[model samples]
Target: MTATHRTYPLDESVDAVIIGTGAGGSPLLWRLAQAGLHVVALEAGRAWSDPSADFATDEVAQSKLYWLDERLSGGDQPTAFGANNSGIGVGGSTLHYGAYVPRADPRDLRLHSLQGVAVDWPLDYADLTRYYQEVETFLGVSGPSPYPWDPARSYPLPPIALNTAAHIMRRGCDTLGIKTSPAPIAALSQPYLATGSEHRHPCVHRGYCHQGCRNGAKASMDVTYLPAAVAAGAEIRPQSFVTGIERDPQGRITAVLYDRNGITERQRCNAVFLCAGAIETPRQLLLWQAADSTLPLNDAVGRNFMAHVSTQVWATFPQPTYLYRGFPSTLITEDLMRPDDADFAGGYLIQSYGILPIMWAEQVARSRPLLGQSLVDYLMQYPHVSGLGINGETLPNADNRVTLSSEKDARGLPKPHITLTLGENEERIHLHADPTLRAILTAAGGADLWISRRTAHTIGTCRMGTHAKNSVVGPYGRSWDIPNLYIADNSVFPTSLAANPALTIMALALRTADHFLQQR
Candidate 1:
């Protein structure tokens, strides 16, 4: 098999087939292949082999990296899709993510046992700490030697240099007597070599992290695990969107079907890994369930949808904060993330925020309802304004779910219809923190505030648990109903954490892959 780009014959039965190449599937692909298993990965988006040629600094032009398919987002507080946070193409959302990588706290796992809301994770912090360290070291994460908030652990690389926005956020946090730390991010701080790949470059503070890092510094999967996986003899088939699964009378998946360039193809495989992300994983399961009622899936397949209540406050400063300047969200504070005095079930953490011009302009336009002149007036403050936001936990709600719409996509699969709404617990968390968020900006000599609300990190459509009745997958991401089917992505996350989900998602992938290796 050719290492760089291998293609398995459709009739050949591969040992394992994974269906996404982001933080989830890529890890499994690399590990499975390293174990000498015949693994194949399918990506729904473009290959993006060359960063310089495939990526553009322009926000609108870079949108080709996003999953812009038609999906109706509606609810009391509807989650917006596409460029804001949804990303596709070869590295998944890591391609456009701000590189804010933080491990989930131990308290985050025992939500139900600790706070009496939501179920506790089937796995624990101790189960993930080693894998977390492995992933951070693999990406050469930049951070304080000993992460201040999670000081038990240490980073492999130095933290990225602080920008103006970070400095300002630090000042405000200091004034409020809050503990802050250099955000542990995936972008390398120095040239670091992966185990089997060439040295990945460090961040240059190009101010386009959100628009998709044009260089290899940001640790997107294209520059990370995907290459390693391919180098290990794993086959990667890009532009292949999986539409269905074929199982024998025994209910074990035998073949995976997908659409590639208007051609429907099938790949025979012994085991199938569904890492199509939160939205699509449930959609695929639901589609399969609807097609055959005899499938052993329960209602948990598409239930317990969750997202972080991303409430942000923006303001202008006298000095140019240059919001678009350095590594985005380079500063963070977890001091207020777990306030025991609050009535809410879970808390939130704050991160300094920045984005490119066009994206920021659109945010102001919609948040302030500014048209021509009013919008231009806000744009004038672009150079001097900055933002700070909280990503708090929202309790898992079966109502906030991904279901098949009456509509179907080009491939004939029903389009996913996701509806999300913030419950009283989430609102209470925001109501308790919004004042402090605004106060921080005020303390930082900021003026002209704009507060915004949205949901981020699509999570928990295929949650894991100890029982088949309560969850779709087990703790190791193996489907409870199907012996040979597994899920390796954020979709299997039991709940949304206050921090970014990428790191933990990757950690879980490592954990699941390790379990698979052990079983073999």
Candidate 2:
């Protein structure tokens, strides 16, 4: 069956109905469709638009992709490390991500077995290696497959040539007896394979990736997986917000009710896959539970929230580094990422590079005085500034979970009330990682280093486990109590990995898609 614009009645039924179209939903969309299973993916955000059609010209389009109101006030709350938020749109947060995708550390996969901290995943790194490779190939990843830095796999493409900032950082790491390599990125450096009839082009180094790459060089789901899924017969509905799930007495999902702005409609389906991400996914589950507590309820449905507690170390240099001339992240240091660290309890992966003067100036404007010559001098020498961000693992805490607030959005649904704070272990990870990052900056002739310890990479609300009592989803990411109800988002993560969650989320989605395909 070929995909066509679907009407509200949905004259035909689908084998699987996926909600959310970002990291987790994208790959699953393609897998289920390719497996010949009827799939319909619902996206709350609008489809990607040309730069001209975007409303707020600057960084607003990137940040507000998910239809977040410019007046939205709750996203900038304080956290265990720093300020963090999420984007909502047709591609979900992937449209706004930094495009730096690294595989989950093998050590990360064995966290439970090694430390006895969280419950062990029913699956491990080896089980997902093949799927990771498939995802890497699909995304056209570029980087070295060295022993210490990468776990092991042939990169689909060569790493991007290092810029001056990257070269300087690499030299500093070499001097410190630490390994620094080109971070595996999803951006096209040289060229990419032309899959199907789509013509993939190489990156032009516009440095405007987060603004929804106009050149189609970035491997966002919009350009990669979603298009593949569409070609394979997957129906995608944008701007459709799923408000409720209608389940039968047998605990199987029957229909998904949604609203487009204000009008309401429903569609019947055999299975429902919730990939709305950590905060929204758990919030939806909790909402469903509140509506009917007897529906295969798990106390852990909204528990065990976790993410990388990140901190940024900014510095002023003597010369212009052209930091924003290319991709924001091209280099990294894993020296401080380890299970056992004395100074910091949590592990951090240090990255160098990001945004430009206008953005950094805005950030500094919020603080550090915006008055006379001081601010003017700061803006004048902005190109000479460089920074290192510490992306580190965080411990899961039941208390640091997402809950529905008394307040509601425009749709009258409860707003996301996140009660999260950094755990002791996470604080330790940053403490250990920052100084090593600072040393690298110092060695590179950096001064006036400013350290910021906050992050927005949220994860692990509806985690997977062997037993229904312990987790919401099962080994294959299906809801343990309700076979038809599946979770394909970051909510399935038990522990935050040492690296970014986006790549691992895609791998999990691939695994889930394979599971569903095998069932057919």
Q: Candidates' TM-scores?
A: 0.97, 0.92
Q: Model 2, 104-208: lDDT tens per residue?
A: 777776666776665566796787888878888888887777625656566788887666667667767777888888888887876687454245688777666
lDDT of each: 0.85, 0.75
RMSD of 1: 1.5
- Candidate 1: the clashing residue pairs are none
For model 1, residues 1-520, the per-residue Cα lDDT tens digits are 1245766898999999899888898888988988888988988998876787777778888888888988888778888778766778878888888889988878989999998889999986888898988889888899997878766788989999988888888899889898889999899889999776567778889888877887799988888888888888899888998878899999999999998887999999999999888888888889888888888887887777888988888899998777677897899888877786787877899998876678777778668877888878889889888889888998888888899999987666788888888899999988977888898899999999888876778889999999988889998999999999999888888889887899998899888888988987
Candidate 2 has what TM-score? 0.92
Q: What is the lDDT of residue 38 in candidate 1?
A: 91
- RMSD of every candidate to native, in Å, equals 1.5, 3.1
lDDT of 1 at 7: 68
